[model samples]
Target: MTANLNLYSCDLTDISLSIETILQVVRESKGIDILINNAGIGKFALAEDLELDHWNRVLTLNLTIPFLLTKYVLPHMKRQNFGRLIHITSDADHIGFAEGSLYCASKFGLRGFADSVRQELKGTPITVTTIGPGRVDTFFNGKKPGDRPISLNADDVADQVMHVLSQGQRCEIERIYLKSTFE
Candidate 1:
């Protein structure tokens, strides 16, 4: 069976436009049932060496965008009474790396936001979950999938996402962390 999918591309950092687009999509689709906040960019540099512009860009994309998206999508979810909000965070949320100050901060904030939202929706059918994966084989950081033997394959993380989505309304997961066994 073919899945019904509608693809959209936009600069998520453009806050107003992004929110408008999201709302339009929800209206066009009739309602929103799930939201996955996965757009992120990593600008790795020592704290002192990282430019202010890069820091702001990283924070905007990695943190602010997700929050804004969630803010907009939540009302539809609440109205629907059954919805899932998933965030693709990073292990940086747990451990800070030397050159990943900006990335780590954003990811950490994402996890916190998800956790808080989860609590806020405790009695509701809406569920919030954050997935933290360590070094996935993807185009992130100018790296290819096969570049890091110690990295988790993108499919591995997707499988976990599927698991979260497959759960019943009675199951609300808070977090899922994926790491290569070698790490």
Candidate 2:
């Protein structure tokens, strides 16, 4: 399916810093029916070796960006009486892995963020959802498509998102946790 695309490359961390720019961008889009907060980064290093920059980058991208985007989009969603905020977190949100202390911290924070936001939006038509998927075969980790064994494919992830988007107005899905299995 083909859809209209709006691409902006400004620093999400600076999104708040430049409120005018963000508001202008938001104005350009006008409004959003569905927001997929999928931008994230992983700095795979032990706690000691993890630099402050890496830690901040991961936390800002994984945790803070979603919050900011959600904040910006909710008003539009509220105005329309409908919206879906989907956070593409990772299994790290649920369980911490070795050399992933910083990564896990960011994801765990996202889990908490979703939990609180979902409750806050209970009476509204806006729905907050967090999808935590196990290792996926993507370019993020230097893996080529279809080259990994039994890892979640990109399309599978998209299908799951589409499922949420297809839900009726009365339905509210809180969370989806997917695990990869060897097949």
Point out the worst 10-residue segment of candidate 2 by lDDT.
13-22
| Model 2 agreement with the true structure over 1-183: per-residue lDDT tens digits | 998877766666665663555576679986778888887788888899989988888888888778787788788888988999888888899898899899899999998998899899899888888888887888775567767758888777788899889998889888888877774
Candidate 2 global CA lDDT score: 0.82
- Model 2 TM-score, 2 decimals: 0.87
Encode model 1's per-residue lDDT on 1-183: one tens digit a residue.
Answer: 996788878889888788888877877776788899989999988899989999888889998889888888888889888899999999999899899888999999999999999988999999998999998888999988788978799889889889999999999888999899987
Query: What overall lDDT goes with each candidate model?
Result: 0.89, 0.82
> Per-prediction count of colliding residue pairs?
0, 0
Q: Which candidate is the best by TM-score?
A: 1
TM-score of each: 0.94, 0.87
| lDDT (Cα, 0-100) at 168 in candidate 1 | 98
Error of 1 at 52 (Å): 1.5
Which candidate number would show the highest lDDT if scored against the true structure?
A: 1
